[model samples]
Target: MIRFYHAPGTRGIRPIWLCEELGIDYGVEMIEFTKEFRASPAWRKISPLGKVPVLVDTADDLLMYESCAMVQYLLDRYGNGQLQPQLGTPEHAIYQQWNWFAESTFARPLGEIVNHGREFPGENLIPAVVAEMQNRGEQCAIAVGEAIADKAFILGDNFSAADINLGYSIMLAERFLSNGLPESIKPYWQRLSSRPAFIRATR
Candidate 1:
């Protein structure tokens, strides 16, 4: 069985959702972000960064980090080519494109917002940084919305790892939308929230 060390509302959701999609047997160990948990030597051993969503492939004792990499690895190892597009195909290229975009472009900016907000809560100087991050996230959201506006999934017709990657960004955007979001991104959030896998993952 695979062991997943995760935290709620974090990147851990990516692999957890993938596990559900693959119907794979896995064990989840939730890690609290408290000082005590962060200070644990054992947890630090598994993830030097002390981040959640670390997967221990017990069979081979492989420890993996980074949500996108883990999701891609799981799909490649266990999905039997079901949820991933064929390499060298057009669909595969698109899949790889959005997969990287979600992390580098979309999630990175949004994370900056949360990190800045938390690090400097109510600090006047930090508001500018937060606003900049918010703008970047909006741009990313619009791009994602445009890509999936006509299709049901990111990769043409079938659901693929790209969806898993981008879908998580869409979900994160929804949390911020309640406060305020770019008008162009509303429908995109709706489409992602309506997916069955998203519903299951949220629950």
Candidate 2:
């Protein structure tokens, strides 16, 4: 069986939702949110940065960690291209673009906001940094709004792993942005989060 190691309410949610969306028979190991345990020698061998998502494919004796990669693995090996565009197509390129945008662009400032608040809860933390992060996060949200404008999903009428990737970041953005999600973004999130797979993965 496939194994998924994750922590609730973290980036791990992306892979969990992907697995659920795929309907693959897999085992999920819910690790607590603890930096110490993740950074320990044993854990560091698998994940260099003590991240929450680590996937072990016992069937193939494979060890992989990166949530986006896991989603790609599941889709490539098991999906039959159900939730993504056909490889090498123009739409596929768009899919890849949004997936990268989710993690690289949008999630960054949101994570900064979280880290700044978490690492320094009091006035010791610079309010300017937090505000700046929030501003950047909102900017990212605007780009998302433009991308998702009038579309039921990111890549148009179809639902894809890109949605899982982008939607999960949107989930975190909601918490990080003090201004809340833009009106345009809320419906997209509602559509993604309403999935049974999303609900199951979140719990």
Candidate 3:
């Protein structure tokens, strides 16, 4: 069986949603989101960086930390070619592109905003720094909006795991962006968020 160490509202949603979409049976172990708990030796043994959403495949004696990697792993191992394009194809390349963009590019600034707030709270928070990060995040959001302007999902009409990867980042943008998601992205956002899998994963 696969065991997922998860916390509500965390990146684990990416893999959890994938499991739901593919109808893969899995178990979730909710973890404390508190730093004190995360920093404990017990937690560190499972997650070196004390991050939430550790995936442990007891059947294979495998464990994984990065949430996005977990998503890819599940897709590769159990997806049976469901939510992705053919391997090594241009469409697959674009799929990988969007997945990376969702995490490394788009989620970076939003995470910084979060880190900045945690590191410098209350009056100590720097407005300029937050504004800069917000600008960067918004730029990524605009790029995503334009990319999917005419398509149903990130890679044209098909719904793929790339959507699951990008959806989490969009959720973060909605929470952290000063003005929230731009007007052009609203319809796309509605479509992604309204998906039954997304709703189940989030809940």
Could you give candidate 2's per-residue lDDT for residues 1-203 as a string of tens digits?
78888877888788778889888888888876676787698878878887768888877888888788888888898888799989999999999999998988988899888778778988779989989988988988889988889799999999999999998889988998888999979889889999999999998
Ranking by lDDT: 3, 2, 1
Global lDDT scores for all candidate models: 0.78, 0.87, 0.92
Off by over 4 Å in 2: none
Superposition TM-score, candidate 2 onto the true structure: 0.95
In candidate 3, list every pair of residues with a backbone clash. Answer: none
TM-score of 3: 0.98
TM-scores, one per candidate: 0.90, 0.95, 0.98
Q: Give the C-alpha lDDT of model 2.
A: 0.87
Better of 1 and 3 by lDDT: 3
Name the candidate, 2 or 3, with the larger TM-score value: 3
lDDT of 1: 0.78
Off by over 4 Å in 3: none
Q: What value of lDDT does candidate 3 attain over all alpha carbons?
A: 0.92
